[model samples]
Target: MTRRISKTKQFIMMNPIIQFFKFIYLSLKVLVIVAGGHGGTR
Candidate 1:
């Protein structure tokens, strides 16, 4: 039970950093797709 609590606390601490990286990754993916689409059209 104590280990679970500590693990949950650690996850809570890391959640924001994880979310930030996920957001950056998603933005990069979108940018790549948009670039590809523009290049293909031209």
Candidate 2:
């Protein structure tokens, strides 16, 4: 039970950083897709 609690605590601590990186990743992906679509249309 203690180990499970510690794991949950660790996950809670790390979740925000993970979400931040994920947000950046999604933004980059969207930018690339938009650029590709614009270039393709030309």
Candidate 3:
């Protein structure tokens, strides 16, 4: 029970940073896709 509690706390602490990195990764993927499409059109 104590281990589970600690694990939950660690996950909660890391959640925001994980979300931030995921957002950055998704935005970068979109940007690359858009740039590729634009380049193809040109």
Candidate 4:
């Protein structure tokens, strides 16, 4: 039972780390798009 509770806690803790990395990845993609002059040269 204790192990199950700890596993749940670990799962909860990991969710935000995954979300944070997703946010960073999205922001970097946006930055790259903007830096390329909004597809003007494309």
In order, the Cα lDDT scores of the candidates are: 0.79, 0.79, 0.79, 0.78
Off by over 4 Å in 4: 1-14, 39-42
| Candidate 2 weakest lDDT stretch, 10 residues | 1-10
lDDT of 4: 0.78
Error of 1 at 40 (Å): 7.9
Return the lDDT, model 1, position 32: 95
Q: For model 4, how does the per-residue alpha-carbon lDDT over 7-33 read when each residue is reduced to its tens digit? A: 676776679887798789989999998
Q: For candidate 2, give the lDDT of residue 6.
A: 80
**Which candidate gets the maximum TM-score versus the true structure?**
2
Q: Which ten residues in a row have the lowest lDDT in candidate 4?
A: 1-10
lDDT of 3 by residue, 1-42 (tens): 246568777886579888798789889999999887643555
Q: Give per-model TM-scores.
A: 0.49, 0.50, 0.49, 0.49
Candidate 1 C-alpha lDDT tens digits along 1-42: 246568777886579888798789889999999887643555
